[model samples]
Target: MTTNESIGDKFISHRMLSSFDINDELLQKLNTKGFTLKSEIQAVSDDTLRLMCNLSDEQLNTINELIRKSHKTIINHLTVSHIRKLSGNRIHTSLPSLDIALGGGLEVSKVTQICGEGGVGKTQICMQLCITVQIPEQFGGLSSHALYIDTENNLRPERLQSMAAFCLESYPELKQRYCAESMVSNVHLFSCNTNSRDLFELIMSRIEHFLDHHQEVRLVIIDSIANLFRYDYKGNEFQREYEISQMGHKIKSIAHRKRVAFLISNQVTYIPVEGKDTPALGKLWQTYCSTSFLIKRYGEYRKTYTLKSVNIETDRHFFFQITKNGIKEVLPDEVVDAIINNNKL
Candidate 1:
């Protein structure tokens, strides 16, 4: 609902100013001098701010200290205590090898971006998480619901149905605990067009209410966040870039506040000469990504996935494949060929 372009941009605010010991007159004076913008105040020298607003040296020093605290509060409210408490409560993705690689699964209060070209099983992985999150926690689930923003309009219920059927057969007790229909229905899908701004608004508005009222929600999936901005503002590069960064901030804020895991699929970009590839939005988008996983085709039926993150202890790279029952570990050609031959069995 807060549509102003500069709404979340200011790390400094009137609230921060009023919280200080400064009088109303000086605050009014600071306001008159157009010191409302955090960047403007942060850019100008403290001496300059003092000169322009006519402040005492002691008052200026206090204001600067308060400003730093305010920025830290607004930018990152995560305290050491909160991190310690939530450390063990991770969202296990339900894939054994990936669970080991991720040290569990996708983590709450952080963003995990899955990067890969088209048809590389990115969406399949997201859908799997959506379904898996419904299982009870003791059985590797978050026992939660999910919000899926389908940017590409590619979320297929048939695929989900098939996957859910597999889960029901494999873990019939999980099915008994919670009905299959309930799990499928819990994954609320929102179709977002190419307008990143609208998509952002949709997400921000629903994030709090969804998590608060629907206590089952523990995951948020934005399948291909890069596409919305790419299509809408192709010529207006500046606006496009701004929206992307702002969107990232909003998503991170919601994830941390709600303590929900974010699975964002991103389009892959690469350098031909170096044979290096990364997500499309550049480092600006990377600032919020707690973990990044890149997917590349290995041979024919297999795909390679590499995990990278400064926060995590180790990097994991492995081969997997898109199969009838969602993503699974790749098997050797001989093993696969033998399995395919009914006579050999």
Candidate 2:
């Protein structure tokens, strides 16, 4: 039996790929078709792959399993002490009640998925995080840069400008230290279009450049990870799920291992019944995420509900409203009641 080491998450060495069930003709087809890495084979669509490689159903299933094993089994163990060490570099969302609801803040090396309907302030929270992640550690930040991947073309510069101004005004001592002047520069904002393929290729291909050069970045925010799939991929559930789930897995592998935090916003699909709707990408992604939250709009108030969390209550809810400054705290119902009672008095 031949053995090969995992090279930067590779399934097997390119030369040893033929040691398996792949015939010479099939291997030639794969090489000519430019399928090198196991991840590439996994990421490609089955229909397109069929056209390219003319693979039978059995062969395709085998290849799929190989790819899955490559990524999943390659990293099958993590010690508790290792996880504890990684969890130390937590980044606060800076919304006090929301922070309390989150049991502290977003942990380093974890995925926090925020799901909500359109206009539910998911992007607003992302924008706020891009700023908050840079706050000095004394004030509950990682004191590092942020990487913003705007998949739906929603990285609002005007909003960042206004928010940065507010941040400077709010944290005058930090402003005196000149943190605000270069805040946006530390936060790399990228706007990706509707095509998921473009987004995927961009991340996988260009990751080394940014990830290596920007170790200072502690948070990566994908403003609505489900946006590209929602508009496209109608009637193509398998391909959509495969691509999205694989992308999710890849992002998790990179983010956690690099000790960087990920905040991904997922859109919601309405159910028109009880519970109203659920996260758009379904249960695969719901569980793929370390913690899942949902945002709902009511009149002028928006409530963020935790749908899934390992260490926090799923039933817990936090009230917040987006203001010009950024995602700001809003009075809870009890606080509102107390205010009304005081006014009556």
Candidate 3:
């Protein structure tokens, strides 16, 4: 006849657990009432079910229902899983919608390369993402910091300042909350003019410091992986093949280990395939990268177009203009259709 509340109160109020001590009688009563011994103390205790104990079948069902309801409430309130070992989950980017395109809105500890030819807004995109990632979750971001490893001539304070100013104009509150105190504080940049061993060592040191200091680093961008490749090897085809592959493997491993998104830019060159010419980043580079994007200037349009060549089921091409702003995704269907219709000549 004991109500759930009454039972909880009885259990909570019972000092018998301490006074009576462990005995056959106590164990019998507990077992009869539905208290079972948990086998693995570490495994089940650490799970989403914060507390689960042996109880009568009815009581167990009630507790399970309560836990389910609690989970539903949390989900309804829009709280989701936090990134593992990440301080927070708001990632800022130059383009807000770009984050949306990336499932979980970026900052989930995966390598996301943004490759393009020279002056195609690769570094700019990375910088913008850094700025956006530092903004709080309430403002629609991962609410995490960024670390930028600039291997080229792309680290410009004034440029970042200008980008921040632009973001401020769009979202005044975000500017007030994050940018007013310089959210860029959360962003650490390594702009060393070194290559290969020196570059790797510098990055390794900085990465350690960032991981130690910041609980979460949403993004790490290595601008132009080509720099290290060109500098390390003397353009010997055989040497280049092995070296680039090794570089890619190491980069991929680093990204996986750190669990931060990596966006590495690469150089492109024209190679003869069969009887025709194709633009690519050599054989090793292509083989090593999980995703490959080909970017080239669209004639004299002063804009660069990007081709997402990896992971396509059909022979469909995607094009996006590279502006002073950043890499924007152009819908494949609309652009391709327009190109075909207009270029009937």
TM-score leader: 2
Worst 10 residues of 1 by lDDT: 3-12
Which pairs, if any, clash in model 2? none
| C-alpha TM-score for every candidate | 0.71, 0.71, 0.58
CA error at residue 118 for candidate 1, angstroms = 0.7
The per-residue C-alpha lDDT of model 1 at residue 345 equals 20
Alpha-carbon lDDT, every model: 0.69, 0.70, 0.51
TM-score, structure 3 vs. true: 0.58
lDDT tens digits, residue span 45-65, model 1: 788789977988987877777
lDDT of 2 by residue, 315-345 (tens): 6877777787887777686446545655421
RMSD of each: 9.8, 8.8, 15.9
lDDT (10s digit) by residue, model 3, range 1-345? 334333232222211221223445444544332232221111123332223334455544444454445434433433112212232253544443344333335544344555556775667667777776666676655667678787886877766766666667768777546563385566787775576666656554556566667667767777876777665767676666645544554554455455566666776554546652233346545433333444444432222232322122212334454445444555545555556656521
lDDT of 1: 0.69
Per-model tally of clashing residue pairs: 1, 0, 19
Error of 3 at 108 (Å): 2.4
